[model samples]
Target chain A: MSDLSRLSLNQATIKYAGMEQAVSACLRAEIPGIGLWREPVAEYGLRKTGALLRQAGLTPTSMCRGGFFTSPDSDQRIKDLADNRAAVDECAELGVPELVLVSGGLPDGSRDVDGARSMVLDSLAELAPYAGERGVRLAIEPLHPMFCSDRCVVATLGQALDLASRFPAEQVGVVVDTYHIWWDPTVYQAIERAEGRISAFQVCDWITPLPAGVLLGRGMMGDGCIELRRMREAVDKAGYTGPIEVEIFNQEIWDADAMEIAELTAARYVEHVL
Target chain B: MSDLSRLSLNQATIKYAGMEQAVSACLRAEIPGIGLWREPVAEYGLRKTGALLRQAGLTPTSMCRGGFFTSPDSDQRIKDLADNRAAVDECAELGVPELVLVSGGLPDGSRDVDGARSMVLDSLAELAPYAGERGVRLAIEPLHPMFCSDRCVVATLGQALDLASRFPAEQVGVVVDTYHIWWDPTVYQAIERAEGRISAFQVCDWITPLPAGVLLGRGMMGDGCIELRRMREAVDKAGYTGPIEVEIFNQEIWDADAMEIAELTAARYVEHVL
Candidate 1:
């Protein structure tokens, strides 16, 4: 069996699981960390969820997300920034150091990607310090280009780092997700460049024949063609000694039994990623 | 009416139409150029297809594709190389100057992307000379990262150029497809770097909620969020004054009447791309 010491469950991997079941599974499997999402945490009551995790001695690795900073509408931008700030507060409350930020896609009906990216930076300017003061690092997650139009405008790890460079390293950093960035030609160098700014190292394999909307296409570690172990080594070499979170968003895996999913993920983490 | 001077109808846009219908639509619209795919041209008799385009006073802009050069099997690699040579011969036969190369995905069940990319360069080294001798430039088309797994491994214009840079510019160049490269953060600079090495400029807008396969997700020019005119200008500024090929691969467009698709593409080309 692989070492589960650094393995963190992103919770999205077994997407339908309740907090109670997720923590129970982690505790049973000796998985030391669990990354929580905002919606489910709110549903379970944040204080109670924190109590359960603290009681179980499970480290809350990172929060789900807190960035949609690309809308053209002024009101929408204000609301998104506020939501991001609230997300940072939540991360601080949970004792999670990193809050994942999915920079939103282009403004509706706008074709200016560069402009949208600029807006991402502008929003970061406003939110980074606030997050830093809360002891929460804003981790910019670069979703694959397939989601560039609908989900995150940050399409490359390099771009994410470029955005993060403007703010303090502790306040702003990049997420090195294998699923989103495995296809990048400059990935190794970008990972090396990430160095101290690497906030969270998320793992998921990229399987082909992406589903409609192309949202839930992530694979279990060994099921796809990603060089998971190689990337893990690279991220580790770049000074990232944090929890390695498995964050597959595939539908079939989500539909499977939660405990089974966690078990298989742990096994695969040992076989393919470790 | 939009200037049909440089507009080229890539036959795949009206995917079901025969050679005669495609040529007729282009002729009727006064579109001066056409891009042909190998399958349909082979079906129609290569010489006869050439004669038909010549008779219709149409220019054959580019040969659809010729690069699946990423198999570990020696026999498969030999067959693929021979096929690429045949594609070059077809391009020369139809008097087309450029043959689009879609550097294939990873070897079956392989996670070595770097190794797959190296294989692409090795194949290009063999094919470029043969293509150049026949007066055809191998146009390295960097397909979108979404296709990096199944369809094409060259996932960025910069990567394509890096591969192309090793060969003589006349023998090896790159294709700038709006649908593929528009999401790239450094795209504009990459276009400028392409300079005289740009062999073809293909236009197709990117739309979201991509279909299951993600292959037919290309949108007609103005129907999506891509800034086509800006890219068109950049390509022109990069010294590419060649045929502007409209190559939409949407199944819905393919199902529509051929003539209507051509007309709408022409209108959109004028409005959004010209």
Candidate 2:
């Protein structure tokens, strides 16, 4: 069995729950770590939520997101950078070490994925130092390639590492989400390559018959084909001793009671991801 | 602009059409080639279909498809291999040089993606010589990573090439479908690496909000975001001057009039994919 101390409940897994409920769910499940989303933190007042988590003895594992820098418009690019900077500030305030980023997709009517990827590098270059100075790592998360067109241009851990290679390990890192990277053939090698630069080790399952939009199709642990334990071991072997955040986004998962889902996630994590 | 002489209508784009309708639509659109599917060819008698294509002066660009070699059961693997051999024979009989192979996904209840991938190599080792002797190249088509679980495990041009590298070039090669590979960060490098071993160059567009059961979610050319022209040029530069087959699988396209889709595909070929 795995240690419950390392499992973090990412708030998006029970997206229906607000700060207090999410905290309660995590507490009930005995999941020692909790990943916060900027929206919930903002809604609950960042300082208040941070205070509550600290009082409850919960480690804020990471922050949900802070990157969508693929817009071609200079104004949009400026705004996106500012938003990332704000996210960095939020992570720092919440005592979250990792600020996970989902790099934005191609510009409207644009087919230049290469160009979009370069924009991510530029975004990273600008944000990494700021994040590092604030004791936060800008964690680039590569979403599944299915989301490459409309969601994230970073489609592989190798690509994420490539982007992070330019920055110090303290400044920039990559999010290793099993749901996204499990399908990659070079995944193990990439995981090994990401040793020092792994910011967040997120867990989720990948199931088929992906729903429309494909964003909320992540399966719960043991509910899909991914060898979750194998991936967990790979990440662990790669020298990441941080929290393993359960970050599922399925509609079915979200529709369930938050406490029930969190407890179930904890149980499944032990069964499938240990 | 691309040469009309090199354009091939892969029948799946207008999947509603039977062999006769596909041929008629190809004729109406002045397309010089057609990619045949095994199901339709079996429905229309192999010899008769081959004779009809020859009479219509249309080249059989490729045959779709032949490879589900990921089954773990020894008996099932044997069955799959026998079926693939039969597919190669069908392709040979139909005068199609490229037998497009979608190496099957993880076996039911199997999470061994690495083991499943090795099975592909073993399958290739068994099938390549047989295909080479029969004047057919087993063209491994690495599907988009989205299909990596249940449709095709070979999910990148690089992986396909790795499987093909062991076999003689005359026996094994790969299909470079723009829709499947366009999102890859190393796509251009992989394409260049696949120079002499590129057996098929299929074209299609990729749009967002992927329909449930994404098998039929491919977009019509010029309808979605794919750098079709650039990919085509890359293939040409890589020394592949073979028939550029337009293979789309979309419910919307399937529901459309076959001849209209054919004509539109031709127009889109000129405007978007040339």
Candidate 3:
């Protein structure tokens, strides 16, 4: 039998369920880990969510996300920095290992992507030290390029690593999610370069002939063509022994029974990834 | 009046029109440049199409495409390389400055994007010498990440440049199409780094609240929220003085009259960009 202990279920995999229900479902399935999002945590209250997960004997894998550093105005940027500091505080309070970050996209009313990226770096520099002191490692999640306009400025593993390399490894690192970066040519090299600084490793399949322009077309394991074993091998080779988080966002799966989705994800992790 | 001399029309913008019809429309409108595709040229016969464009004073800006380097087997890769060499010959014969390359996506039954990229690089190395001998520059077009699985492997401008930097500038360059790369955070810096290697600059708008699952949701010039003038300025600052090709692939624009679309594109370029 394969070891299924390394599997983690990101809450987004069954986001339709309330935070309490999700925690119960994870407990029911005996899934080893959970990745929490801010919205649900805020709704249920952080202390309650933390207590629920702890009661379920689940390790919090990583926080859902916390970066959007690009803005057209200086005041807006300062406000975003403040917001990120708050996210860091939340992650620390939740006792999560890392605070996942989706770097902000281009500033509104502007097309200078490079300029916006510099602003992201500046914001990260400001937030990393605060997050470091709080014992919450900043895990930069490089989203797919499709989200580069309105979602995240960090769009590749290499770019994320480049940004992370600027800070101390203990303060800033990267999250390797198969759904966001499986198509990137430099992903393997970037992962290798990331070494032990890979704070999180995520898995989800990419559905072919992508469903229109919806940015969130995440497929469940074995439903799409991602070679999970190979990606896991890459992470292992890079010395990352963190829990493998299942972070799917498929609408069909989300609409299904949350317990069923959580159970299926755990089974898929055992059957496909392990 | 703003100079219309710099405007070029990509055939895909009017995909509904026949090659002869597209050429006739360009001639009627007095547009100076035309980007041709192999399918239409093959359909109408190359000799006749070449003669028609030549007689109409249409300078072929760049060939439609010539790279699909990733495949599941060596035989398929060999076939792709041979086809690309033939495309290089066609571009040379047509006297175009560059042969646009959409480095093909993942090979079937393969999830190793790095391996697929190696295949692409190997194929380019095999084809570049031949392309260089024929005086045709291979322009690597960094398609949107949505196309990364089924369409093209090169998904970001930085990734494309990193690959291109492996070869001589004359042998490998890039096609900066706004539709494919407007969302990249490092797009401007990547373009600036590309500098003398920016062979072609293409334009298209991005529509938000995109339709479901169809990843190729291209917007027309003024229909979406892309900062066209800013993109133009970026390309200009990169020192590319080539034709500013309007290369929209929107269903709405394609369903319109070809002549009307061309006229509208020209008008938009003048009003928004000039």
Global Cα RMSD, each model: 0.9, 1.2, 3.2
Whichever of 2 and 3 has more lDDT, that candidate is 2
lDDT of 3 by residue, A123-201 (tens): 8889999999999999999888777767787888888988999999999999999988887666778889989789999
Best by TM-score: 1
Residue lDDT tens for model 2, A1-274:
4579899999999999988999999999999999989998999998999899998899999998899989899998898899889999988888899999999999889988888899989889998889999999999999999999998999999999999999999999999999998999899999999999999999988898898878888999888999899999999999988899999888888999999998999999899887
- Candidate 2 on B189-221: residue-level lDDT in tens? 999999899999999999988888888888888
Q: Which ten-residue region of model 2 chain A has the weakest summed lDDT?
A: A1-10
Better of 1 and 3 by DockQ: 1
Q: Show the colliding residue pairs in model 1.
A: none
Worst 10 residues of 2 chain B by lDDT: B1-10
Q: Which of the numbered candidates is closest to the native, going by highest DockQ?
A: 1
Clashing pairs in model 3? A211-B213, A211-B214, A212-B212, A212-B213, A212-B214
lDDT of 3 by residue, B173-263 (tens): 9999988887665677888998988889888787665566554477777666567888889889989899988887767778999998877
| Per-candidate DockQ vs. reference | 0.85, 0.83, 0.49
The list of candidate 1 runs beyond 4 A from truth reads none
- Model 2 misplacement above 4 A: none
**How much of the real interface does each model capture, measured as fnat?**
0.78, 0.74, 0.62
Write model 1 residue lDDT over A1-274, tens digit each, in one string.
Answer: 5579999988988779999999987877778899889999999999999999999999999998899899898998899899999999999888999999999998888888989999999999999999999999999999999889888899999999999999889999999999899999999999999999998999989887888988888889999999999999999999999999999888899899999888887888999888
